[model samples]
Target: MLEVNHISLTFNEGTPDEKKALQHIQLKLNKGDFVTVIGSNGAGKSTLMNIISGALFPDVGKVTINEKNVTLLQEFKRSNYIGRVFQDPMAGTSPTMTIEENLAMAYSRNKKRTLKLGVNKNRRAFFKSALATLHLGLEQRLNAKVGLLSGGERQALSLLMATFTEPDILLLDEHTAALDPSRAALITNLTKEVVEKTGLTTLMVTHNMQQALDLGNRLIMMDKGQIILDISGAEKQALTIEKLLHEFQRIRGEQMGDDRAILG
Candidate 1:
């Protein structure tokens, strides 16, 4: 459902201190494809997602959603096609808004807003059902401010809001990176569950090796702004973290540098 073609972005080009984030990167995701992206720091993982989400426009190349070219689309213009959850729990939702209010905004995203009440009987019923699926007792706390939630709770709510409309593409920028092991696992499980239920095409950048292997149907490794490896189906199912590390070191001709990825 998403296609990125020969996209490249460079910062401070033609000057000292220039950095290239994406090096003509190309990725195509099919409908309902769940792709997990892994890489060391500065591997263009986040940059790729930003280009897809229109958070950062590529100096060259194009982005398409459902065959509609969005390369020239501004960030706000592309919001209708993308749903993003950042690493920071506080980035996605309004701290002052209640759980239901935040959901109301999500419900209205990419559409004209109305002067009617924020939550009517039908919307409350839908909200309650959606919140109940989080299994966090948030359905009963619709009036609770989102700021009152824990890190995991807030991130979980953020995930819900991102998928409330089931955008054509879901971009997850290490959405669970800030949580502890237990909470991270919880959020990760919720993420998979929500994606499977909604059948949304997803791109997730994660450092946790096991979670990467366990969650997505396709696995890819990136280095120097290019995809180094892409595996799927039987091949991906049989791959282990140790083997992945070995492959990385062999391909890059250096030790894999992500200690967090190794430790996890």
Candidate 2:
């Protein structure tokens, strides 16, 4: 349901600090396809996500969702159909807003605004039900300011908010990277559960190799602003971490140098 065609982006062009962020990147995701992206730092994983989400427009090529070209659409406009959770738990949520208020804003996404109050009796019930799915007891803290929550709780809430409406495409940019192991595991399980239940088309960038192998139907490896490897189906299923590392070394002719990716 999403297509990125020959997309390329550069920063500080024609200057001493100019660097190519993405080069001729082409990707396609069918409806309900969950693709996991893995790479070292500066590999253009987040750059690709930003381009797809409309936070950055590629200098070349186009992005199409459900046959509609959205290459130049503004970020807020794309929010109607694109759901994203950032690396930082704090990025997705407003520290000042209460739990229910944050959820209420997410619930109102893509819907025409009106004079009606944002949160009501029925909406509260719905928000409570949704929060209950996170199993974080946030349903009991609907009025609590989000800043009061722990990192894991806030990340869980962010995940819930992003998927609340089942947007056409979901972008997860190393979302669990900031959490401890246990909390990361919790969010990972929740991600799998929500995506399976909703059948949302997803692109998740992660430094964790095991997570990339375990979660998605397809796997992509990027380096130096280009996709170096794309594997799926039985090939992806049969892949192991050792083999993946070997493949990276083989294709790129250099060992993967990012310790975080290797150790994750």
Candidate 3:
């Protein structure tokens, strides 16, 4: 339901520090498609996400969602169709708001705000029921401030908030990167569950190789602002971490430099 066509971007254009973050990048994602993006530092992974989310506009070409061109749309305007969970738990949530309050706000994200902002009994029950699916016992903490939660708990709640409305597309920008191994795994599994349940088209940028492989139906590897490898179906099914690393070495004709991706 998303199409990125012939898009290109450069930073500090015509200056000494000028760098091309993306170049003639093209991608099309169908409804319910889940794509995992992988790359080393400065590989344009986050740049691509930003462009799609309207946080950055491409210097060339267009971004379309559901056949509507949104290349010139503002970030807030595009929030109606996009749900995102950032790398930092603190970024996606309001620290002072209670869990249910935060959820209430997210639920109203794309809707017209009414004069009444308070959560009523039915909305509170809905929030509790939704939080219960995380299986983190957060349903009992509806009134607890989100700041009181642990990193994993906050991230889990953030995930819940993002998917609560089932936005047309979900962007996960290394969402579990800041958590410990155990919490990362938990969030990863939860991500899969939520995506499957909602059938939300998704693009996830991850430094973790295993995570890239283990989730999503399509895998994209980018380098130097271009997509170097795109694997899916049978090719993706046969993929392994060792083979992926070898392929990277083959493509670059040099040792892969991102140690976090290699070690992950």
Candidate 4:
């Protein structure tokens, strides 16, 4: 459903701070494929998501959704084709807006709009039903300020908000990294539910190796911006953290003892 072909990115070009963030990375996601991406820090995990979401441009590459080239598209233009939940909870939500009001914006994303800010009764019912999926009682708290929510609650709502329009691709950038373990687990499960129910193609960047193996239909490991490993189907089902770590060392020719991966 989505493809990244021959993409590379370099930051601070021509300066001492110059760093190559990605190196000819190529990847493809089939329809309904939940691909979990895992790697050590600086492995270009977030960079790949940024490129896909159009928050960052590639030095060279082509990004396509269903065969259409979106390489040169602006970030806002890409938003029409994609849904994203960032690492930061605040990034995806408006602090001042009430819960239902925030969703009203998302509901009207692709549709033409005027100054009609009031939520119709049917749309209100739809938002309530969607909020119920989060199991946070947000459906009953539609008038509450989003800023008053806890980290986990906010993240759950953010996930709901991102998938509100059901775009072509869903980019989850360590979405649960900010929540507590129990809350993270809840959101992770909710992630699977929403994606499966909506049939949304998803790319999830996670630091937890176990979560990577346990959640997605496919698995990918990266190091230094290059995709060094990819596995799916029965192969992915049989994967263990030990085996994944072993593969990283085998392909990247580096030690596989990153605490982020081992302990996460």
Candidate 2, residues 1-264, lDDT tens digits: the string is: 999999999999999999899999999999999999999999999999999999899999999999999999999998899999999999999999999999989887889878899999999999999999999999999999999999999999999999988899999999999999999999999999999999999999999999999998999999989999999999999999999999999998899999989899
**How much is 221 displaced in model 3, in angstroms?**
0.4
How well is each residue in 132-234 modelled by candidate 1, as lDDT tens digits? 9999999999999999999999999999999989899999999999999899999999999999999999999998889889988999999888999999888
With a 3 Å backbone cut-off (N, CA, C), the pairs that clash in candidate 4 are none
Candidate 3 TM-score, true structure as reference: 0.98
Top candidate by lDDT: 2
lDDT leaderboard ranking? 2, 3, 1, 4
Candidate 3 lDDT by residue in tens digits, 12-78: 9999999999999999999998999999999999999999999999999999999999999999999
lDDT of 1: 0.92
lDDT head-to-head 2 vs 3, winner = 2
| Per-candidate RMSD, Å | 0.9, 0.7, 0.8, 1.2
- Give lDDT: candidate 4, residue 169: 88
Question: Which of the two, 1 or 2, has more TM-score?
Answer: 2
TM-scores, all candidates, are 0.98, 0.99, 0.98, 0.97
How far in Å is the alpha carbon of 6 misplaced in model 3? 0.8
lDDT of 4 by residue, 53-158 (tens): 8888899999998899999898987788888898898888898999888899877766767787658788899999999988888999999999999888889988
Model 3: how far residue 217 lies from native, Å:
0.2
The weakest ten consecutive residues by lDDT in model 1 span 109-118
